[model samples]
Target: MTRQSISITAPNDHWLKAQVENEEYASKSEVVNDLIRKARAQQDEIEWIRAKLIKAEQSGFTDESPAEILTAFKEEARRNGDL
Candidate 1:
Protein backbone atom coordinates (compact mmCIF):
# COMPACT_ATOMS: atom_id res chain seq x y z
CA MET A 1 0.00 0.00 0.00
CA THR A 2 1.08 3.55 -0.69
CA ARG A 3 1.35 6.15 2.09
CA GLN A 4 0.63 9.83 1.82
CA SER A 5 1.17 12.71 4.24
CA ILE A 6 -1.47 15.40 4.65
CA SER A 7 -2.09 18.39 6.92
CA ILE A 8 -5.26 18.82 8.94
CA THR A 9 -6.71 21.32 11.43
CA ALA A 10 -5.80 21.02 15.09
CA PRO A 11 -9.36 20.03 16.06
CA ASN A 12 -9.50 17.38 13.37
CA ASP A 13 -6.07 16.09 14.34
CA HIS A 14 -7.19 15.90 17.96
CA TRP A 15 -10.24 13.86 16.98
CA LEU A 16 -8.12 11.37 15.01
CA LYS A 17 -5.69 10.97 17.88
CA ALA A 18 -8.59 10.53 20.30
CA GLN A 19 -9.81 7.57 18.23
CA VAL A 20 -6.52 5.79 18.86
CA GLU A 21 -6.38 6.88 22.51
CA ASN A 22 -9.90 5.51 23.06
CA GLU A 23 -8.86 2.24 21.37
CA GLU A 24 -11.61 2.71 18.79
CA TYR A 25 -8.87 2.54 16.15
CA ALA A 26 -5.35 1.15 16.24
CA SER A 27 -3.93 4.03 14.24
CA LYS A 28 -4.82 7.36 12.64
CA SER A 29 -4.66 5.69 9.21
CA GLU A 30 -7.39 3.27 10.23
CA VAL A 31 -9.61 6.16 11.32
CA VAL A 32 -8.99 8.02 8.07
CA ASN A 33 -9.67 4.89 6.01
CA ASP A 34 -12.93 4.21 7.88
CA LEU A 35 -14.04 7.81 7.32
CA ILE A 36 -13.16 7.53 3.63
CA ARG A 37 -15.11 4.28 3.33
CA LYS A 38 -18.15 5.91 4.95
CA ALA A 39 -17.83 8.95 2.66
CA ARG A 40 -17.62 6.72 -0.42
CA ALA A 41 -20.69 4.77 0.67
CA GLN A 42 -22.60 8.02 1.20
CA GLN A 43 -21.56 9.29 -2.22
CA ASP A 44 -22.65 6.02 -3.83
CA GLU A 45 -26.04 6.35 -2.15
CA ILE A 46 -26.35 9.96 -3.32
CA GLU A 47 -25.55 8.98 -6.91
CA TRP A 48 -28.02 6.11 -6.81
CA ILE A 49 -30.78 8.41 -5.51
CA ARG A 50 -29.94 10.95 -8.21
CA ALA A 51 -30.23 8.32 -10.92
CA LYS A 52 -33.51 7.06 -9.52
CA LEU A 53 -34.87 10.60 -9.35
CA ILE A 54 -33.90 11.24 -12.98
CA LYS A 55 -35.51 8.00 -14.06
CA ALA A 56 -38.66 8.85 -12.12
CA GLU A 57 -38.77 12.24 -13.86
CA GLN A 58 -38.49 10.58 -17.25
CA SER A 59 -41.22 8.11 -16.27
CA GLY A 60 -43.65 11.04 -15.96
CA PHE A 61 -46.40 11.76 -13.43
CA THR A 62 -48.26 9.25 -11.28
CA ASP A 63 -51.96 9.23 -10.32
CA GLU A 64 -51.21 8.03 -6.78
CA SER A 65 -52.11 10.40 -3.96
CA PRO A 66 -49.71 11.29 -1.13
CA ALA A 67 -51.11 8.60 1.19
CA GLU A 68 -51.05 6.02 -1.57
CA ILE A 69 -47.47 6.97 -2.40
CA LEU A 70 -46.52 6.59 1.27
CA THR A 71 -48.16 3.18 1.45
CA ALA A 72 -46.38 2.01 -1.67
CA PHE A 73 -43.09 3.38 -0.39
CA LYS A 74 -43.51 1.49 2.90
CA GLU A 75 -44.33 -1.71 1.04
CA GLU A 76 -41.32 -1.35 -1.21
CA ALA A 77 -39.07 -0.58 1.74
CA ARG A 78 -40.35 -3.65 3.58
CA ARG A 79 -39.91 -5.84 0.53
CA ASN A 80 -36.33 -4.61 0.19
CA GLY A 81 -35.70 -5.33 3.93
CA ASP A 82 -34.98 -1.65 4.51
CA LEU A 83 -37.75 -1.32 7.06
Candidate 2:
Protein backbone atom coordinates (compact mmCIF):
# COMPACT_ATOMS: atom_id res chain seq x y z
CA MET A 1 0.00 0.00 0.00
CA THR A 2 1.00 3.59 -0.55
CA ARG A 3 1.91 5.77 2.43
CA GLN A 4 0.50 9.26 2.86
CA SER A 5 1.65 12.24 4.94
CA ILE A 6 -1.28 14.59 5.08
CA SER A 7 -2.15 16.83 8.00
CA ILE A 8 -5.57 17.59 9.45
CA THR A 9 -7.05 20.03 11.94
CA ALA A 10 -7.15 19.28 15.67
CA PRO A 11 -10.86 18.42 15.60
CA ASN A 12 -10.45 16.07 12.65
CA ASP A 13 -7.41 14.46 14.24
CA HIS A 14 -9.35 14.04 17.49
CA TRP A 15 -12.19 12.45 15.60
CA LEU A 16 -9.88 9.96 13.97
CA LYS A 17 -8.32 9.17 17.35
CA ALA A 18 -11.76 8.64 18.81
CA GLN A 19 -12.62 6.27 15.99
CA VAL A 20 -9.48 4.25 16.81
CA GLU A 21 -10.22 4.35 20.55
CA ASN A 22 -13.72 3.08 19.93
CA GLU A 23 -12.29 0.34 17.72
CA GLU A 24 -14.41 1.48 14.82
CA TYR A 25 -11.31 1.49 12.63
CA ALA A 26 -7.93 -0.21 12.85
CA SER A 27 -6.05 2.98 12.00
CA LYS A 28 -6.36 6.50 10.63
CA SER A 29 -5.51 5.23 7.17
CA GLU A 30 -8.37 2.75 7.31
CA VAL A 31 -10.81 5.42 8.41
CA VAL A 32 -9.68 7.79 5.66
CA ASN A 33 -9.94 5.04 3.06
CA ASP A 34 -13.43 4.08 4.17
CA LEU A 35 -14.53 7.73 4.05
CA ILE A 36 -13.05 8.07 0.57
CA ARG A 37 -14.93 4.98 -0.58
CA LYS A 38 -18.21 6.33 0.76
CA ALA A 39 -17.61 9.73 -0.87
CA ARG A 40 -16.86 8.06 -4.20
CA ALA A 41 -20.05 6.02 -3.97
CA GLN A 42 -22.06 9.16 -3.25
CA GLN A 43 -20.44 10.93 -6.19
CA ASP A 44 -21.41 8.03 -8.46
CA GLU A 45 -24.97 8.24 -7.24
CA ILE A 46 -24.99 11.99 -7.89
CA GLU A 47 -23.73 11.43 -11.43
CA TRP A 48 -26.47 8.87 -12.04
CA ILE A 49 -29.10 11.32 -10.82
CA ARG A 50 -27.64 14.11 -12.95
CA ALA A 51 -27.75 11.93 -16.06
CA LYS A 52 -31.35 10.93 -15.31
CA LEU A 53 -32.31 14.59 -14.89
CA ILE A 54 -30.70 15.48 -18.23
CA LYS A 55 -32.50 12.65 -19.98
CA ALA A 56 -35.81 13.59 -18.38
CA GLU A 57 -35.37 17.17 -19.50
CA GLN A 58 -34.72 16.04 -23.04
CA SER A 59 -37.70 13.64 -23.05
CA GLY A 60 -40.24 16.43 -22.26
CA PHE A 61 -43.32 16.00 -20.03
CA THR A 62 -44.35 12.66 -18.60
CA ASP A 63 -47.88 11.32 -18.06
CA GLU A 64 -47.00 9.82 -14.66
CA SER A 65 -48.23 11.46 -11.48
CA PRO A 66 -45.87 12.99 -8.96
CA ALA A 67 -46.55 10.18 -6.49
CA GLU A 68 -45.78 7.59 -9.12
CA ILE A 69 -42.56 9.37 -10.03
CA LEU A 70 -41.46 9.53 -6.41
CA THR A 71 -42.22 5.86 -5.84
CA ALA A 72 -40.31 4.86 -8.93
CA PHE A 73 -37.36 7.02 -7.87
CA LYS A 74 -37.29 5.47 -4.41
CA GLU A 75 -37.45 1.97 -5.88
CA GLU A 76 -34.60 2.73 -8.23
CA ALA A 77 -32.52 4.16 -5.38
CA ARG A 78 -33.12 1.04 -3.32
CA ARG A 79 -32.11 -1.16 -6.21
CA ASN A 80 -28.90 0.88 -6.56
CA GLY A 81 -28.11 0.42 -2.84
CA ASP A 82 -28.54 4.14 -2.16
CA LEU A 83 -31.46 3.79 0.20
The 10 consecutive residues of candidate 1 with the worst lDDT sum are 63-72
Evaluate all candidate structures by whole-model CA lDDT and list the values in order: 0.79, 0.82
Candidate 1 stretches with Cα past 4 Å from truth are 63-83
| Candidate 2, 30-65: lDDT as tens digits | 999999999998888777766766566557777665
- Listed in order, each prediction's TM-score against the native is 0.73, 0.74
What global local distance difference test value does model 2 have?
0.82
Candidate with top TM-score is 2
Each prediction's number of clashing residue pairs: 0, 0
Indicate the worst ten consecutive residues by lDDT in candidate 2. 62-71
Query: Could you report the Cα RMSD, in angstroms, for every candidate shown?
Result: 5.1, 4.1
lDDT of 1 at 40: 90
Candidate with best lDDT: 2
TM-score of 1: 0.73
Look at candidate 1 and tell me the lDDT of residue 78.
79
- Backbone steric clashes in candidate 1, count: 0
